[model samples]
Target chain A: MRVRVFADADWPQVWQIVHEVVRAQETFPYDPAMTDGQARDAWIEAPPGLTVVAVDRDRVVGTAKMGPNRSGPGAHVSTASFMVAAADRGRGVGTALLDFAVGWAKAEGYAAMQFNAVVETNRSAVELYRRHGFEVVGTVPRSFAHPTLGRVGLHVMYREF
Target chain B: MRVRVFADADWPQVWQIVHEVVRAQETFPYDPAMTDGQARDAWIEAPPGLTVVAVDRDRVVGTAKMGPNRSGPGAHVSTASFMVAAADRGRGVGTALLDFAVGWAKAEGYAAMQFNAVVETNRSAVELYRRHGFEVVGTVPRSFAHPTLGRVGLHVMYREF
Candidate 1:
C-alpha cells in the first residue's frame, strides 16, 4: 500500500471508515452520532495541518489526520489520529499511514508527536504504536468507555523526533 | 470573594488577567502573542459551557471557564481553566474560583472534571488542584517549554464527582 495526500474524492471512503470506527465504540471516543459535516470538519485539517490516505490497488484502505497538538508554545509538539478499514486489517495499511504521518511531522519540524487518547483495550493499536517507538507516557484511568470492557483507561502515547 | 457569571462589563479586567498569565509564559501554554479577539474567543464559553469571574468588592480578581472535555461520548467529563490576578495570589482567589467551577460542573451533571494540561512548574496551581481533590493522573514528560526552566512535564489532573 502507498500513502498519499487525501483528496476531495476520498471523503466518502474516509467518512465510511470514521463512521464505522466511531460506531464500534471500541477504539475512538468520538460521538457515534456525529453528522457527516461534523466528521468532515473534524477530520479534514486546514492550513498547516494535513490529511492522508493509504491506497491499495485503487482502493482506500486507511486514513490519518495530523497537526499541532495545541496552539502557541504547545504547537511544537504534533498529534495525529488514524483509522484503517476493518476488512483491510492485516495488510499493513495502518503502518504505511503511520510512517507517512511521522515523516510529515518530522519534516514539518515538530519536536515530538503525542497521541492524547488511545483506548487501553485496543491492544493492537497500542502494540503497533509501541513497535514504532512510541511510549505510553501516561494513562488516564477509567476515561474511555469500551462497549464490552465497560470503562477503561486511555493511554497518552508519545514519541520524540 | 463571590463568583458570578461573566458579563460584558468584566471583559476588560478578565482580559488583563488573561494577558498577564499568558504573557508570563510560566503557567498556561497559551500563545503569548494572542490578539484580544483571539483571547476572547478562547476564554469565553458558548452555550453548553459557562464562564465566571470572582468578584471581590466590585473588583474581578479571578476567572474560570468550564465545559465538556470532549464532544460526544467523552462529553460526560468536564474540563476547566482558571486565571487569577498576580497581585491577588495569596488571598485565596484561585481556591474560590476552583470551588465555583467544581460546583458548576456537578450541577451540570458532569461525571468528572479533567484538566488536560497543568504545568509542573506551577507549584501553587498544582497544589491548589490537589487540595480540591484533583489527582495527577499522568504527567507527559518534557511537553511544556518553560522560559527559564527549559522543558517541564504537563500534568493531566482529574477529579471524579
Candidate 2:
C-alpha cells in the first residue's frame, strides 16, 4: 500500500470509511448524523494542515488528517486522527498512515504530537500508537460513550519528536 | 458583584480585561497580537453557548465564555474559559465567574464540565477550579510554554454532574 496527499477524487471513498466509523460510534466522538459537507470540512485540512489517503492498487484503504493541536503557544505541538476501511483492518494500513503523519509533523517542525481523545475501548489503535513511540499521558475517565461498552475513558496519547 | 449575559456594550471593558490577560502570556494560550475582532470572536458565544460578564457596581470586572467542549457525543460535556481584570485580582471575581459558569452548565443540561487546558503554573486558577470540584483528570506535560516558567503541563480538569 502507498500513502499520498488526499485529492478531491478521494472524498467518496474517504466518506464511506468515515461514515461507517462514525455510525459505529465505538471510537471517534463525531456526530453520527454528520452530513457530507460537515464530514468533508472536518476531515479536509487546509494550508498548514493536511489530509492523506492510503491506497492499495488504486483503492483508498485509509485516511488521516493532521495539524497543530492548538494555535499560539500550543501550536508547537501537533495532533492527528486516522480512519482505516473496516475491511482493510489488520493489513497495516493504519500503521502506514500513522508513520506518514509522524514524518509529516516532524518535517513541519512540530516539537511533539498529541492525540486528544483515543477511546480506551479501541485497544488496537491505542496499542498501535504505543508501538509507534506514543504514550498514554492521561486518560479522562468515562468521557467517551462506546456503544457496547457504555461510557469509557478517553486516553490522551502523546509522542515527542 | 452580579454576573449577567455579556452584551455588546460590555465589549470595551471586556476587551480591556481580555487584552491584559492574553498579553501576559501567563495563563491563556491566545495569540499575544490577536486583533479586536479575533479576540471578540474567541470571547463571545452564541445561542447554545453563552458568554457572561461579572459586573461590579457599573463596571465589567471579569468575563467567561462557555459551551460544549466538542461537537456531537462529546457535546454532553461542557467547557469554559475565564478572565478577570488585572487590577481586580484577588477580589473574588474569578471565583464568582466560575460559580456562574458551573451553574449555567448544569442548567443547560450538560452531563459534566471539562476544561481542556489549564496552565499548571497558574496555581491560583488551578486551586480555584479544584475548590469548585474540578479534578485534574490528566496533565499533558510540557504542552504549554510559560513566559517565565518555560515549559509547563496543561491539565485537563473535569467535574461530573
Candidate 3:
C-alpha cells in the first residue's frame, strides 16, 4: 500500500471507517451520531495540519490526520489520529499510516508526536504505538465508556523525535 | 467574593484576566497575541459548558469555565480552567473559583474533572489543584516553551467528584 496526501475523493471510504469505529463506541471519543458533515469538518483539517490516506490498488484502506496538538507555545509538539479499514487490520495499514505521520511531523519540525485519548482496551493500537517508540505518558482512568468494556482508560501516548 | 454565573457584562473584566495570563506566556497554551474576539470565543463557552465569574464587591476577580472534557461517550467526565486577576494572587480568588467550578460540575452530574494541560512551571496553580483533590496523572515533557525557563512540562491533572 502507498501512502499519499488525502484528496476529496477519499472522504467516502474514510467516513466509512470513521463511522464504523465511532459507532462501535469502543475507541475514539467522537460522538457516535456525528453526521458526515461534522466528521469531514473535524477530520479534514486545514494548513499547518494535514489529513492523508493509505491506498492499495486504488483502494483507500486507512487514513490519518495530524497537526500541532495545540496552538501557540504547544504547536511544536505534534499529534495524530488514525483509522484503518476493519478488513485491513493486521495487514500493516496502521503502521504505514503512523510511520508516515511521524515522518511528516519530523519533517514539519515538530519536537514530538503525541496521541491523546487512545483507548486502553485497544491492545493492537497500543502495541503498534509502543513499537513505534511511543510510550503511555498518562492514562485518564475510566475516561472512555466502551460499549462492551463498561469503562476503559484513555492513554495519552507520546514519542519524541 | 461571591461566585455567580457569568454574564455578557463580565467580558471586559474577564478579558483582563485572560489577557494578562495569556500574555505572560507562562501558564496557558493560548497564543499570547490572541485578540479579544478570539479570547472571548474560546473562553466564553456555550451551553452544556459554563463560564462564571467570582465577584468581589462588583469586581470580577476571577473566572472559571467548565464542560465535558471530551464529547459523546467521554462527556460524563468534565474539565475546567481558571483565570484570576494577577493582582489578586494569594488572595484566595483562585481557590474560590475552582471550588465553585468543582461544585458546579458535581451538581451537573459529572463523574470527574480533568485538566488536560497544567503548565508544570506554574507551581502555585498546581499546588492549588492538589489542595483541591487533583493529582498529576501524567506530564508531557517540554510541551510548553516558557519565555524564561526555555521549556517546561505540561501536567494532566485529574480529580473524581
Candidate 4:
C-alpha cells in the first residue's frame, strides 16, 4: 500500500471510514451524528496541516491528519489522528498512514508527535503506536465513555522525532 | 475573595491577566503578541462551556474556563485552563479558581477534568493542580518551546470526581 496526498475526490471514501469509526463510538472522539460538512471541516484539514490517504490497488483504505497540537509556542509539537476502513483492519493501512504522518512532521520541523486522546480500550491502536515508537505518556481516567463498556481512560501517546 | 460568573464588563480585567500570562510565555501556550480580540476569542467560552472570574474586592484577579475537550463521544470529559494576575500569584487566587472550576465541572455532571498541555517548567501551576487532586497522567517530550529553556515537556494532568 502507498500513502498519498488526499484529493477532493477522496472525500467520499474518507467519509466512509470516518462514518464507520464514529458510529461505532468505540475509538474516536467525534460526534457519531456529525454531518458531512462537519466531518469534512474537522477531519480534512487545510494548509499547514495535512490530510492524507492510504491506497491499496487504487482503493482508499485509510486516512490520517497531522498538524500543530496547539497554537503559538506549542505549535512546534505536531499531533495526529487516524482512521481505517472497518474491513481494512490489520491490513497495514494504518501503519502506512502513521509512517507518512511521522515523516511529514519531521520534515516539517516538528520536535515531537502526540496523540491527544487514544481511548485505552482501542487496544489495536495503542499497540500499533507502541510498535511505531510511541509511548503512553499519560492516561486521563474515566475521560471517555465507551458505548458498551461505560467510562474508560484516554491515553495520551507521544513520540519524539 | 469571591468567585463569580464572568460578564462582558469583565473583559478588560480578564484581558489584563491573560495579557500578563501570554506575554511571559512561561506558562500558557498562547502567542505572546496575541491581539486583544484574538485572546478574547480564544479565552472566552460560549454556550455549552463556562468562563468565570475570581474577584478580590471588585477586582478580577483570576479567571478560569471549562468545557468539553472534544465533541460527541468524548464530550463527557471536561477540561479547563486558568490564569491569575502575575502580581496576584501566591495569594490563594489560583487555589480559589481551581476550586471553583472543579466544583463547576462536577455541577455540570462532567465525568472528569483534564488539562491537555501543562508546561512542566511551570512548577507552581503543576504543584497547584497536584494539591487539588490532579495527577500527572502523561507528558509529551519536547512538546513545548520555552522562550529561554529551549524545549520542555508538556504534562497532561487529570482528575475524576
- What are the candidates' individual DockQ scores? 0.67, 0.71, 0.85, 0.76
Best by TM-score: 3
Residues B57-83, candidate 1, lDDT per residue (tens digit)?
999999999998876657778899999
Of the candidates numbered 1 and 3, which has the greater lDDT value?
3
- Per-residue lDDT tens digits for candidate 3, residues A97-158, read 99999999999999999998999999999999999999999999988999878878999999
Predicted candidate 4 versus true structure: per-residue lDDT over B74-149, tens digit per residue: 8987899999998898999889989988998899998788899899999999999999998988888787878999
Residue pairs in steric clash, candidate 1?
none
TM-score, predicted candidate 4 vs. hidden true structure: 0.94
* Worst window of 10 by summed lDDT in candidate 2 chain A: A142-151
**CA lDDT of every candidate:** 0.90, 0.92, 0.93, 0.90
As for candidate 2, its clashing pairs are none
Q: Rank the candidates by lDDT, best first.
A: 3, 2, 1, 4
**Candidate 3 - chain A - TM:** 0.98
Off by over 4 Å in 1: none
Q: Best by lDDT, which number?
A: 3
Candidate 2: stretches off by over 4 Å: none
C-alpha RMSD between model 3 and the true structure: 1.1
lDDT of 4 by residue, A1-161 (tens): 89999999999999998988999999998899998898999998897999999998989999999988887779888999999999989888888999999999999998888898899999999999999999998888777789999888889898888
- Kindly report which residue pairs in candidate 3 clash with one another: none
Task: Give the runs in model 4 whose Cα sits over 4 Å from its true position.
Answer: none
